[model samples]
Structure formats: C-alpha cells, structure tokens
Target: MTQFIVSLAVFLALHSIPAIPAIRQRFIRVLGRRPYLVLYSLASLAALAWVFHAAFQLDYVELWPPSAWQAWFPLTLSPVAFFLLISGLFSANPVSVTFRRGDMKPGAVVSITRHPVLWGFLLWAAGHIVANGDLRSLMLFGCFALFALFGMVMAERRNWSNPLNASTSIIPFAAIAQGRARFGIDPAMILALALTVALSAWLLLGGHAALFGTDPLAMTST
Candidate 1:
C-alpha cells in the first residue's frame, strides 16, 4: 500500500492546490499560458495513472471482498461517468469551451458551480468507495470524495460571480432536455459519443491490457 498512498498523496496535493489568482497569474507569467496548461495537464494525468497502478499492484488482502452491495457501483456510476465524458467532449458547454475561446476567466464555470470537475471527482470517488470496502481504499476514496465536495461548496462561496453572456452560457442539462428541439446533433459529436461509449465498454469488459497494461477486474474477485 506504500505505492498507493504515495500516488494518492501526490495526486491529491496537485489537485488540491487552491485556484489563487496571484499564484495562477505568476505561473502563467513564468511559463506562458499554453506551456503551463500542458505541463499541469500532463502532471495530473500521470498522478492519476500512478494511483491506479499502485492500487492494483497491492498484494491480495481481503480488506473487503466484492459483495452484492457492489451491484450499485455500475448503476450509480454510469450516469456520472457519462456526464463527465460527454461534458469533456462537447464544445458547447461553457466550462469546456473556455480555453478555446481565449478566456482564462475562472468565474465562467463558477457561475454555475465553482467546479464542475470537482463535482465529477466527488461522484467518481464516492462510487469507488461504495464498491470497495477495504480500509485503505475507503480512506483514500473517502478523503478525496470529501475534499471534492468541500471544494465545490467553498469555491462557490469564495469566488466572485460573473455576468452571463446569454449567447455563450450553457443551459443546464435538464433545461436542454426540456428544450431539446433547439439542439442539433452534429456528425462529429455523434462520432465522438459513439467512440467514447465504445471505449468505456471496452474498459469495463476486462480489456484493460489494451489501455492500462492489465485487467482491473482480475485484481479483485471481491
């Protein structure tokens, strides 16, 4: 579990860096915007990979075996995962589109909720904790879950609200569903969604060797 803890610590520390304007400004000034973004993104991805690698490499210890309760894992996780996946792909969402539009404005996403990504993290962490009952797993996922939840609430209250540009602002998912007629499905969007779903299914079906070097399910019979 040493590797697991180390990876989790590094991941959490990097992620938990509060979005201080001055700190962000300094980083951008020093590295220039694109380089800073690329470096941080790569670091975050590496940290996540390390966490999974550490977790799966652990010696078999029955902290908690897979139970019928874990049936809830996929059921609860599917929608949240879909949301994150879809939100990441679509250019229409105000949050995802910010970088492309030449705006580093923090409050664009905050107006809806301070951090949509943190919200996704909370969902993922909670789902994993429910599915894995081991002390180490529980502690790791639980702490991150709580951190993400608190981060969203704290950020909401701390950040300044920006005026919405109606032309660019995104409607909530529910609102979009209600007004579905106004939405158009482009060919590229359709292809992207199809690919994402296919990839997710492949990962779910013990095909991790193709992506992450080993099947995740093979690590747990519990």
Candidate 2:
C-alpha cells in the first residue's frame, strides 16, 4: 500500500508534466526536444511498471464479489481501448496526446476523438474497476480514470484557442459528424489493430493469468 501510494504519486507527477506546457518546454529547452521526449517516454513507462509492481503488493479487500459480466466488460472493451491507445500514440495528433512528430495530420482515430488515448485509458480504468470490485483495484484503476478525465479536460482547455482544434473535438466523432474533421485510415491504425488483436488473444488465452495471476476467461466462467 505504501509502495502503491508512492508509485501512484510519481506517476501522477510525471503525467502532470504534459499538462503544464511551461514545465515541459523548460525540460525540452534544457534536454533538447528529441532527447527530452525520449527520456520522458522511458520514464513514463518505468513509472507505469512501478505502479503495477506496487499495486500487486497491495492487500485485496473486495468491495464487491467478481461477476462474469464484470470481468467480460473489460475484456470486451479491451480491443477498442488498446486500439485507441496504440493509434493515438502512433499518430502525429498535434491536437492531443502524441509521442512523436509526424506529417502534422491527425489520423483516423483522432477524427473520432482528439483525446483517444485518454478515452482509451478511461475505458480501461472504468472497466477494470467494475471487473475487480476491490479496494486495491479501485485505488489502482480509479486514479487512472481520474487522470484520464483530467487530461481530456486539460488538453481541450489548453488547446481550445489553437486553429488546429477547430477541426477536432473532445467527444468521439463529433468533429466528423459536424464536418469539421475528415476521417481517413492511417497505416498506424492498421498496425495498431493487428497488435491489439494479438495482445487481446494472448490475454484471453492464459497470458493474463501468467502475468497477473487471474484469468478473465476463467473469471467469466465462474
């Protein structure tokens, strides 16, 4: 629990960097853009690993007994969540979360939501909270849900004045529906879907149990 809190704090702090442009620019100016981005990305991954490590150390105190539907909910949502996660990370997405510079275009996923990564994270967190139904899981996933919500709001508010945002929106597909944004496939979207499918298959076929000590398929069966 102590470790979980500490790691959560570090994760929150690290993520907050992107929410603050001044701080991010300062670090970029000092480290150089590409190096700063690379280092930050690595640190973000390390912080996430620490969060999972610490969370597994927590005592399981059930808030509600697990149910088949509960477990299945997250499993069902996992593909879409991961697809958004991968596609958003891969796209240039000048309007939202992006890991690298590209052709200055928001990809197909971004046309759905400028904040696809955050929406993916939100779905992941909310689904897991329902699936696990435990204090530890709540703490772990709840923070993530809140973070994703906060990120979406912050990103929208911060970028609201930018002309690029005129073509995008916070709600999924709203921009495209309004004809503000156009939808088109991205190479990254294809790769992301392929990777998500492989990942989902592995998780369903006992890999999740191998890593996390529980099987969603088994959970749904019981």
Candidate 3:
C-alpha cells in the first residue's frame, strides 16, 4: 500500500512539470523538443508500470462482482479509445497536449476533440476500473481517470485564447455539432483506424493476457 501510494505520487509530480508552460519550455530548450518528448514518454511509462506493479502487490478487495457486460463494455470501447489515442498522438494540437509538434495536421481527430489524447486515457482508465472492480483497482484507475480529466481542464485554461479553440472543444463531438469544426476521413483518421484494428486484434487474441494476468476476452467475468 505504501509503495502504491508513493508510486502514484511520483507519477502525479512528474506529470505536473509539463502542465506549466515555463517549466516545460525550459526542458524543451535544454533537451530539444523531440528528446524531451522521448524522455518524458519513457519516464511516464516507467512510472505507470511501477504504479501497476505496486497496486498488484497490495491485497485485492472486491468492490463488486464482475459481469460479462463489464468485460464486453471495454472491448467494445477499445476501437474508439485507440482511435483517439493514435490520432491525437499524430496531431499538432495547439489547444492541447500532443506528441508530434511538426508536419502532422490538426485534422479529423482535433475536429472531434482538442483533447483526444486525454479522452483516450480517460476511457482506458474507466474501462480498467470497470473490468477490475476491486478496491485497489478503483483507487488506481480512478485516480488515472481523474488525472486525465484534470489535464483537460488545465489545457483549457492554459490555452483559453488559442485560435484553434475557436473551432475545437474538450468534449468530443461538441465542436462538430456546433459547426465549429469539420469531420472527415483524413490521413490521420485512416492511420488511426488501421492501427486501432491491429491493436484490438492483438489484445483480444492473446496480447492482453500475455502482458497482464487476466484475459479480457474470457467468457466468464465473475
């Protein structure tokens, strides 16, 4: 429990650095944008892996009996989640966080939401929370969902006057419904869909259980 708490704290503290523009820019200047992003990704992954490991070390306390729908829910949601994740990673989103800062256009994904990446994380955590349905998992994935949501709020405030925000929104589909942003199958969408399919296949087949103990596609959830 102590290890879990400490790991989560460290994860939060590490993410906090990029929330501030000045600090983020300083690191970018020192390490260069690409290197900074690479380093940040590796560090964040390590922290997240530690969080999961520590959580697993703690005792499991069931919060609810699992059901087939809970298992199916996340599987059905996998495509959309991965779509947002992949598309967001490739977009040059001026109004929110993104990995690629060059070449990639603010196309279809940004049309859905300026914070697609955050939304992806939000869904991923939410799915895991439902799938696990335990005290420790609730704490772990609940915090992750909250973190992604809070990041959206921060991004909104951070780029309040950003020109792109005129057409983009934090809530998915809001911009498109409001006629603020356009939706279509751009290159990013094509790539996102293709990769999403591939990933979903691998995970459903055996990749998920291979990495994590639980097989998500197992017929019995309870």
Candidate 4:
C-alpha cells in the first residue's frame, strides 16, 4: 500500500508539472521543446510503470462484494467509453490539453465534449470500480477517475481562451446548443467511430476474458 501510494503520488506530481505554466515554460526553454516532451513522456511512463507494478503486486481486500447487476454496467457503457476514447484521439480541438492539430474540423466529438479522453478514462474507471468492488480495485480505478477529473479541470484552467469557454458546462452538446460551438461530420470522425465500434466488439467477445480473466458476457448471464 505504501509503495502503491508513493507510485500514485509520483505519477500525479509528474503529470501536474505541465499544468504549471511558468515551470513548464522554464523547462521547455531549458530543455528545448522536443527534448522536454521526450523527457516528460519518459518520466510519465516510468511513473506509470511503477504504478502498474505496485497495483499488480498488491493483495486484494474485499470492500464490497460485486453485485450481479454491476456486471452489466461495463458491458453497457464500454462502447460509449471506447467511442469517446477513440474520438478524442482523433479530435483536433485546441481546447483539449492533448490536442494534436489534425485535418478534421474541431467539432463533432469536440462538440460533444472538449475533454473526451479524460471523460473516457473517467467512465472506464467508474465502471470498473463499481464492477470489481474490492479495495485494490477501488484504489487503482478510483485514482484514475480522480486523475481524469482533475486533468479536465486543470486543462480548462490553463486554456481559458478556449473558444467554448463562454459556456461553463461540460455536458455533451451544451456548448453547441448555446451557439458556443457547432458540429461537423467528416471522414476522420467516421473512421474513428467505426474503429471504436470494432474495438468495443473485440473487447466484449473474448478480449476481456483473455486480459482480465473474466468474461463480461458470462457475467451478464449470471
């Protein structure tokens, strides 16, 4: 537990550095943009590796026994979660802290929510924590949920000039309805959606069992 807590702290601290503009700017100036990015990625990966190691080695303590109905939660929500994950990857919104300028218009998925990746992580974490209902699972997934939510808040604070800033709500389509943003559909978004659906199918079939030693479909049957 101590090691796990330390790993989580290290990971969060490393991630939070980029949220501090002055420190980030100084680091970028000193290290140069490319080198700074490489160093940051490496450090974050190392911290994540530590977190994974600690999590896998930790003994489980049952916090709440898994409810039969809880098993259906991930099965139902994972498609939306994975869609958000993939769509966010393809979105070109400048407001997103993870924004990568792409050919696609910064709408559609961006119109749904500017922070799709974080929202994806938040959903994934919430679903798993509810299904697993154990101390170790709670600690692992709960940390991710908190991290995702915090990252969204920090990113919004850092990019106050975001076009959608006029609307304070993070709910899907809220900005669009308020005329703060608009939706556009294109080939890239189509590709992202198709891929998300395929990936979701693969996970639901046998991938979940192969990776996590449990079949979501079988769980649903019980």
> Which candidate number would show the highest lDDT if scored against the true structure?
2
* The 10-residue segment with the lowest total lDDT in model 3: 96-105
Q: For model 1, how does the per-residue alpha-carbon lDDT over 22-133 read when each residue is reduced to its tens digit?
A: 5555777899868876887799789988887787777645576677557467445754554443443232232232122224333222233324456556677877677666
Best by TM-score: 3
lDDT, candidate 3, 89-111, per-residue tens = 77767666666553346767888
Question: Which candidate, 1 or 4, would have the higher lDDT against the true structure?
Answer: 4
lDDT of 2 by residue, 35-66 (tens): 98899999999999899999988888989887
Ranking by TM-score: 3, 2, 4, 1
Whichever of 1 and 3 has more lDDT, that candidate is: 3
Report the Cα lDDT for residue 11, model 4. 88
lDDT of each: 0.55, 0.85, 0.83, 0.75
Error of 1 at 3 (Å): 4.8
Clashing pairs in 3: none
The TM-score, computed over Cα atoms with residue i paired to residue i, of candidate 1 is: 0.63
RMSD of each: 5.6, 2.2, 2.2, 3.8
TM-score of each: 0.63, 0.89, 0.90, 0.76
Give the true-structure RMSD of model 4: 3.8
lDDT tens per residue, model 4, 135-206: 888998899899889888878787878655664347767877888776767655787789878887887788
